[model samples]
Target: MDKIIIDTAQFQRTISRISHQIIEKHASFDDVVLVGIKRRGAEIAEMLQKRIFELANINLPLMALDITFYRDDLNQANADPIYAGVDNPIPIENKKVILIDDVLFTGRTIRAALDALLDRGRASKIELVIFIDRGHRELPIRADYVGKNIPTSRSETIQVRTEHYDGINQVALLQ
Candidate 1:
């Protein structure tokens, strides 16, 4: 069966809450930069950026990251890897780096993201923000900011759909 975990309204609310949490912690986004994983994560990052701007008039810089090559299981995966490139022009040194991803599953992706991220520049702090944290961690990584925590099994899949990327805004569980 398939289950709808988060609908459009919930998705919007979650993004707003995440943005507020960032604002509360940083007070100002002067030294903050948002780095989103490729595909869906990029869309989420854009939403958060806009929400933060609306809330505090802060226009945080955003960078899109494609960790296709940094993945450890890239060779074992059944799909051809593609390079979409990363958008990081601003100096990340001594700045707060927030890595955004649609879903945090095995933490392997986050690990790869960290590797790709650090290779670019050294930041004072690096935090993770994930829309859904469906636990099945193979690594010791964890998200600093999580929109929702849905305990899931290995046989299930959690899909996050966004209007910007998927033509829909919702989170679904496929079993």
Candidate 2:
């Protein structure tokens, strides 16, 4: 069964709130860049980027990251070796990087993203931002900015769909 957790309006408001919080914390967007994990994360990053642009009138650098090989559980047997749509080599040195993603669960994906990000460039500070944070972290990683925190069991799954990718704007909890 799938149950809706967030509607379109709520999702937009969440993104807006997150944008305002980021601006409030950073105070300036001059040295901040948004780097999103590939797929859904990229969509959310773009949304946040546009929101920030509308609010602060600053066009922050945005980059999409693919961490295929960085994943630890992937098998090399039948998997494709090629990683498509990789990063464009954005300079993150001495900059604040806000990593965006759809959901934060086990923290493995974030770990892989961190490794992939480090391979590109070193940032002065790296913070995580997630639309949904479900609480079953295997690592110590935590989101600096969270849209919603839903305590979920290990068996449940959280899905965040955006119009940019999933053809809808909603968040759902699935069992």
Candidate 3:
């Protein structure tokens, strides 16, 4: 069975709320970089970037971080070794990076993203922003900013559909 947890209106409100939270925490976005995980994460980052710009009138640097090797579904034995995504080579030395993602399940993806970030440059600090926190973390990682918390069982899955990918904006729970 599949159920819609969040609709389009809620999605817009969530992004606005999250944008306000980020602005509240930072007096200045000069050294702050918004790095979204590829695909959905990247799309959310763009949304936040636009929202922040509209609210604060200052544009923050945005980048998409692709963790092909970090994902369990794509990192199989017979998987392709090539990373097809474009490489974003922005120097993040001593900068505060706000890592964005769609969901927080196993912390392995975050760990792999950390590795990729370090390879780019030594960040002063890294804060996480997850659109959904669905529990069941395999590691100690946690999101600093969460749009929503939907506790899920191991047999279930949380899918966040966006206009960029699924032509809709909503959160769906599938079992």
Candidate 4:
């Protein structure tokens, strides 16, 4: 079941729409912080931040969160932990946090991120924003804002690529 549903232009448009919706729902970017999970999630978060800044002229804080060590699947005997460097050390306590991720397949990653965040400090509220929501969630997690909801089989994979890294923006379905 190989399919290329979302093209570059469509992907960009979807992202733009999501950004606008985020700004609208929040009323403003004030006190909002965009925190992206490592790898592609970080890139998506940065792109969203750029759009928000351009649209509202409000520069929201962008933070990177690396949960490599926090993942429940990784074991010390099988893999060595790698930290994807996060730039900000500002405490998230009492701040509105928006967790960004490229794809939401299993809910485990979000759980790990929440754990890591709690270790640092408490957030006033945490809302999830995902570019692609491929359903097969192991936990009860759901996205507050979703770019697209793609029904998928367990064997399928949803890939999200951004212009910042891949020189193009698109979402591809691979088996």
Candidate 5:
């Protein structure tokens, strides 16, 4: 796969800024839950949780969600099949949920995530936080907090690596 480099330093700064923004908007992490989509999204959520605690001195609940089976394109030939599992139980009934993901591509993943989350319980509100927001959304979903926006073709992909998962932190353009 062809690779293009994205500045790691800049990405960290963006994440820090987003964390601060989240804290500011909510004013407190009292009723906030951070739910990360499986794989890279989970890693980002962990980081966000840490940042939130560091910034606000509040320990927010963190959960991981797998929306692979709920994907609309699951039956497609190119859809990479993932063994779905719910690692963390969502216990935020009537609390605000901040869904975290590494990248927002087609927006279908977010839709599936919502379905899975609702199966567990209803949240007071659901906010989206994505590391990368690429255009060409096929669904009406939008992120509440985004680290970066990179416009690219549908054939391309954005790969995010964090120290929690890959032992490094970076974002790359892949083809």
Candidate 6:
């Protein structure tokens, strides 16, 4: 069973606060790019773009990434890594990339994402934004912007429910 931690209202507040922080950090959106990890992460990035546009009236380019091929411990038993690349509509070269993800745990996923991103183009800067940071890092990666940090043991898990997938925005703790 999963215990609900952050509710929908709280999730919205977290996103709104993060959007403000984004605006405060960047002088302009012209040189900034939002790259979201597939599925939940992509949806959250879209929300961030909308929130930023709603607040500053500046629409930033958003890109979705699938990093399956870039994984170090990739199980290629079922799928081919070469065919795992997602469609990148915009170029990230010379732009400040804001890498978005739903959770940050082993940091391996982020390392894979970085590999996938660099394949597209060289970004001037790459900053991470994680909705939940569950702390069990196998690498030195960290999120520059985080919505919430929930420490968990190896036996526990954090599940982020989003509107598109779960019909609601909720963070749950599973033990």
Top candidate when judged by TM-score against the true structure:
1
Candidate 4, run of 10 with poorest lDDT: 76-85
Model 6 scores what on Cα lDDT?
Answer: 0.91
- Per-residue lDDT, model 4, residue 129, is 92
For model 2, state the Cα shift of residue 113 in Å.
0.7
lDDT of 4 by residue, 1-175 (tens): 6477789888878878888989888965567788998878888888889888888887889888898888898884466677866767557998899999999999999999899889878999999999999998899999999999999889888988777777778888999
Cα lDDT, all candidates: 0.92, 0.91, 0.90, 0.86, 0.86, 0.91
CA lDDT for candidate 4: 0.86
What TM-score does candidate 3 reach? 0.94
Q: Tell me each candidate's TM-score.
A: 0.96, 0.94, 0.94, 0.93, 0.90, 0.94
- Residue clash pairs of candidate 2: none
Clashes of each: 0, 0, 0, 0, 0, 0
Candidate 2: stretches off by over 4 Å: 76-82
Q: What is the C-alpha RMSD of each candidate to the true structure, in Å?
A: 1.1, 1.6, 1.7, 1.7, 2.0, 1.8
Of the candidates numbered 2 and 5, which has the greater lDDT value? 2
Misplaced by over 4 Å in model 5 are 1-5, 77-84
Tens digit per residue, CA lDDT, model 1, 2-66:
79999999999999999999989896677999989998998899999999999999999999999
Off by over 4 Å in 3: 71-82, 86-88
Q: What digit string (tens of lDDT, one per residue) describes model 6 on residues 1-175?
A: 8999999999999999999999999887779999999879999999999999999998998888988778887784576555434655689899899999999999988999999889999999999999999999999999999999999998998999999999999999999
Ranking by lDDT: 1, 6, 2, 3, 4, 5
Q: Kindly list the per-residue Cα lDDT of model 2 for residues 1-175, writing each as its tens digit.
A: 9999999999999999999999899977778989989889988999999999999887889999998889887784486666865666588888899999999999999999999888878899999999999998899999999999999999999999989778998999999
